[model samples]
Target chain A: MQFPSLEYLIFFPLAVAAWYAAAPRLRWAVLIGAGAAFLALASPTHFAFAFVLSLVNYFAGLALERWAETRKALWVLLATLAFDVGVLGLFKYGNAVLAGFAQLEALFGVAAPPRVLSLVLPLGISYYSFQLIGYLLEVYWGRQPAARHLGHFAATILFFPKLVAGPIERPHHFLAQLAAPKPFDPADVTAGLKLLGWGLFKKCVIADRIAFVIGPIFGHPRDFSGLPLAAAIALYTVQVYCDFSGYTDVALGSARVLGLELAPNFNHPFSARSVTDFWRRWHISLSSWTNDYIYRPLSMVISFHTSWRRVGTVFSILVTFGVLGLWHGATWNFVLFGLLHGAAVSVEALTSRARTRLLGRLPARVADRLNNVVTVVFYSLSCVLFRANSISDALYILGHAFVGIGHAAPIGAKRMFGRQYHILLLGLVFGALVLGRWWTRRRPVAARPTWQRWPVYYAVIAAIVILGLFQVNQFVYVQF
Target chain B: MTPEAILLEVNKVFAEVFGNPSITVGPTTTAKDVPEWDSLNHTALIAAVEKHFQIKFSLREVMRFQNVGDMCALVRAKTGG
Candidate 1:
């Protein structure tokens, strides 16, 4: 179920209450049962698929642990990884591959075969599969022991809060939390409520409201040009950040109420001074995962073969990011999005020494501001590729973005905002975001006095009630 | 090689690899402690250390080092100092 829906609102509190009321030793059973019920409420078929995969992975971990340091262990590890990746590939890309094959056949003047199967994507399949794969690999690499309790292992994979759009929990961290007992604390509850409110405001008010403007523009970029198109692109950057990060915040807040800590996903990514810094801050869990599993090993092998470390570093970064891009979707736009980021990062790495020297010549504040602006502009432009329906559509918008910079839009302000109040509301929300960032940079909101904190909390709730779209749009990252 | 001697060599390696002659790592110094010691430089740093110490580290071993102290301990164990 969607996080913002009424059903989830009722279901989550009940689940939490039931969980806390259960005996400490029986909590895992309560959690597992709740997780199953949650998944069933969404999709029973997906629930069944996830259950079977969990069983397979659990056994795989056991087998690997038992056969450690032997060739048998190697085979088990390879087999498990292959099976997990194969399942993911089949479900995620099978249709795209088949359609491509049919198109190729048509290009050669041959009749294509009829469609074989209509596959429905299982919810959270991509996320849970990667978590399980990471667990299995950790066991294989001797980094962590195989989980002895099946219920605990299952709970880690099926934890309802992070199961959908994940901070993709690692076994070393998440499993240990599952094993520990979580006693309720008033402080944690208050913090969780505050965080949840903030997330809701960001999603329902900022993101969804902004979507009203950009939705039409992105849907028909060909009809627009100049400043409006640029504004749409820039607003999209804000919308996506608010949407995804809002989801993460809600997930984290929900977990925190139960005294569980989920990893932080975003770290003020827009403020990053470079593309490399942006990756480090944005989607931290996934970036670190790819870095450890894909980039490091590839770099090791390449560095071994050649003394030209720069070439190896550049190549590894490009390939790793290219894979990251493809992970989003099978579309060529996604591929270009990934390649563009990869190229940017590669360039940053190669020119690090020169950039450092050049920046050293300028004042630190000026250098930081310059880099931040450049990074923000670069990311905003790159996001056009991500948001566009096709590569050609993206190019068309980019080509016409500067066509009439100072000209008044053909569409009037009343049409754009629907009312003058919306313009005021949008301005206020945008100002609050900037002010909130500045305020937090000076002193964390949480560290403030309760009298001060309560006003902020109530204000956020007020914003959600007054300004929120309340349409319960699906979180942006759930599609991946 | 003594622990002191290995630390001296490691200091030199860190300084050269990070391009900062003033870098002097202590036992608890980690990747977070050095601005230049990012992932790209990390592999190069490890390779440089392996070459200097004339020892090979398994990938697992390489991944396990949490700080300069851990690296020193591993070097000592491998070199039988």
Candidate 2:
């Protein structure tokens, strides 16, 4: 069941009770059992697959450590990489592969019977696969020891809270806590509940509500143009951030309530000053993962081995982002999304020194303000590419959003907002929350929390139930 | 070479690569501390170090370097002078 669902609401409390009641030594088993049941309830095939993966990687991490720096180390690393990446790639790209075959058969005028090959990619496959690879690499590098307890290792990756979507646990981070689960603390619960409440505010109250308003405009971009299209595109950026980061907060909060801390997945991404800085803040776990495991190694090797180091760095940026984009989906739009960011960051890198010197002449605050606006606008438009159904649709929305330049259309505005003026007020409050995020994160959610602020929390949680548009859609990142 | 001695060598390489002769790095000096050099030029700096020391570092060694101290230790171990 989804984190915000009624079933999960009932299940979470009972699981938390069972967790604390269980003996400390058996806590790992309790987590794994709960996670297994959760995944099995969602899809038994996925549960079985995740169980097998956890077992394989548990042994793989151990074996790699045992044979570290030997030829055997290479073999173990390659084997696990093959297994994890192979299966992940098969499901992740399975539809794209079938689509290619269908196109080829059409070209040849051969009747390919109904093009029925499809694979259901398990939820969090990309997340866990990356985590597994990172875990093995860390053990292989001696950054951390291979986890000794099989149950703890499984629990670390498959914990029910993170099993479906993730903050993508690092072995050194999550495994340490699982190895020695913390004693029960009311502070953890308070902090967790606070995050849970705010996340629901963002998800149910803002993102889901907005998704309905913009549904048809995105569903068929060809239908409308000008302001309606432009507005929908802008709203999409807000919707997605709320949906995904909202999902992350719930995941992290749930884990916190259970007496473990998961790594945070987002910062105030909109506060970033550059495209590069934007990546540093957005989907922080995934960005850092790609940086540490993919980008750095690839760029370093390319720079070290090649005569053209600068060229290699650019190439690596493109390739790394291409992989990042492809990771989102096998669609051309996603590919463009990755390359667009990659290329933008590359331009920023190459011109940064000169740009810094040029901007130095300007007042520092002006330069800072300019950078923030430029960065936000870049990602805001990129949101058009990300949410569109296909590349052509994205291009159409982008081309036509400003086409009818001087025309004022109240009817278009009416259909777009559609008597949901209150939602606009909610958006304003969310904007305030986003503006105060730096403050909120720093002070509240600490040990026991600030009791004075409890009412605000209660109001948000209460508002979610009262005003939230439930069942609007699944969390946008859930399928990924 | 001792790690301390290698740290001196690394300091020189940092100055040359970053083109800032005044730069001096302690054990705790990280990429953040060296404002002139960030992750963008990190590999280039590393390549300079490899050339100066006349020793190659594995990808694992590159990934593990957290600070100037880690770089010095790796250099000392690699050069074995």
Q: Tell how far residue A264 is off in model 2, in angstroms.
A: 1.1
Q: In candidate 2, residue A382 scores what lDDT?
A: 92
Provide the interface RMSD of candidate 1 in angstroms, 1 decimal place. Answer: 1.7
Which residue pairs does candidate 2 place in steric collision?
A: B1-B81
TM-score of candidate 2 on Cα atoms, chains taken together: 0.93
Question: For each candidate, what TM-score against the reference?
Answer: 0.94, 0.93
In model 1, how large is the Cα lDDT of residue A442? 74
Instruction: Tell me the TM-score of model 1.
Output: 0.94
Give the alpha carbon lDDT tens digit for every residue of A1-480 in model 2: 887789889989988998999988889888988888888887888888888888999999889888888999989999999999989988898778788898999999988776654678887788888899889888887778998998888888888888777887786798788778888999999889878877888899888877887887888777677887888888899999999999999999999899998888888899899999999899988888888788888999887678788788889889888988888888888889999999998999889879999999999999999999999989989988899998888898899998775232454554555546755766776676786666667665343355746666666877788878787699888777
Candidate number with greatest TM-score: 1
Candidate 1 chain A: worst 10 consecutive residues by lDDT? Answer: A406-415
Question: Chain B in candidate 2 has what TM-score?
Answer: 0.94
What DockQ does each prediction reach against the true complex? 0.48, 0.72
Interface RMSD of each: 1.7, 1.2
Model 2 chain A: ten consecutive residues of lowest lDDT? A405-414
